[model samples]
Target: MSVEAKNLTFSYEKETVLRDLSIRVPEGEITVFIGANGCGKSTLLRTMARLIQPEKGAVLLSGKSISELKTKEIAKQLSILPQGPTAPEGLTVEQLVKQGRYPHQSWLKQWSPEDETMVENAMEAAAVTSFRNTPVDDLSGGQRQRAWIAMTLAQGADTLLLDEPTTYLDMAHQIDVLDLLHELNEQEGSTIVMVLHDINLACRYADHLVAMQGKSVFAQGRPEDIVTNDMVKQVFHMNCHIAADPIFDTPMVIPYGKGRKPYGAIAAAEAE
Candidate 1:
């Protein structure tokens, strides 16, 4: 489940999004990628998942080139849930999740006991079992998102790559999804690589942090090692107060020095 990227580079037209970026994702842990809006985090993730082929360098899964593996073989070993997976209207959750079993199925070897077990387990892992019969379009945003994750889980892959998994979610639902992914990593020993926009949340949940600057890796290590206030200012171009979460005991970031009120604003509020 370990992933290594060596000299990984990707380009769009004449522009290079990733430049000689390389990092190792440890097996059976959550590795979070954090960067500014156009800093190539998504590009790197797509390349790592083999969704978009890199113009230069290689993404190796367990030291084997991803391109060398058969499509099905690669799928069985790693599954990716790209940002905002779109499903057809009227597709039920069960029907959608069942699609993840495709790698294990063939025209001949279709729908075995193992397939059934995997689908069931995926639903349970994503906590979408109750809504299995609901149409995907009818489900709430978070529920629909979970259904997509269920599909990826049903692939029965050891490594799961998610691009901005918490996109378009409210804070409550964001934590909910993170909690589910945390459970997956702990219980199933799945190696997870994800792009996360929230630095605080990423630091809290990620076992390892990969910070990116434009077209290159800025820094990567345990969250505590790399998520200092100075690092935040350097990577994000903003000032922040860094602290430890009282509840989760993880790095907490509080952005500051934006839109400061006039003098006596605080006392004026109490006087009113």
Candidate 2:
């Protein structure tokens, strides 16, 4: 396993977020965490990334405790893209990407050809090479997100953990960002773990899906195997039809409330 939490517990002061949760993120696959707001999907991800220490148990990276690893060692092994990442004002895309190489820098070598190569390759892989000179804050939401992804890519970590990568993006831009991540997972074999609110999109993208409920995993496995009507109702507390996505053959949720029912199946108020 690239990363796994062993009976981890965490709390935001008094209220517990993760309570004795344990799950292994499969290597070189896309694993998505799904849950309603404040259910601790993001909090679990934070523990996996070592951003917040667990109150009990441990997070193990490659079978070793993450807390025991050096900061640079951890940085070189895993990269994180937190939600709503921001760049300094007037920071060009290239400059931002270059920052990813900081962990590799030491008193011996300030910069190297390998660093430059990684930056270039990362920009190319993320398709943000054209925007290398553009200010990160000046680009569209999708482009800016890609630029930030490039920086994380430049870190050369085989593992990636992201929090709500598609937040604030339009449908098209959301697909664009997700497609980029999918490609990275498919082509580079990167171990990816993410927290996503859109269950349909998560089903489409995830190789392994973990559903959170009451601050613990409700179910986890292949989306097709674990995503059922009952799972949705319990995890999200909403009645939904579990339909296959026409394009991807993944589970698509048709929520049964507050929408126009053109077939006159049921009244909107009745669906509630």
TM-score of each predicted structure versus truth:
0.93, 0.95
On residues 1-272, what C-alpha lDDT tens digit does candidate 2 reach at each position? 47989999999979999999999999999999999999999889888878999999899999999999999999999999999999999999999999999999999988999999999999999999998999998999999999999999999999989999999999999999999999999999999999999999999999999999998999999999999879998998887677789999999988874353423443443466
lDDT of 1 by residue, 1-272 (tens): 67899998888988989999999998889999998898999998888878889988999988899988889999999899998888898899999999999988888898999888989999988999998999999988788889999999999899999999899999988998899999999998889999999998999899999999868998999998888867887889886666689988899986764465324543364346
- Candidate 1, 11: how far from true, in Å? 1.4
Of candidate 2, the 10-residue stretch with the lowest lDDT total is 260-269
Off by over 4 Å in 1: 258-272
Model 1 lDDT on a 0 to 1 scale: 0.89
Off by over 4 Å in 2: 258-272
Query: How many residue pairs clash per model?
Result: 0, 0
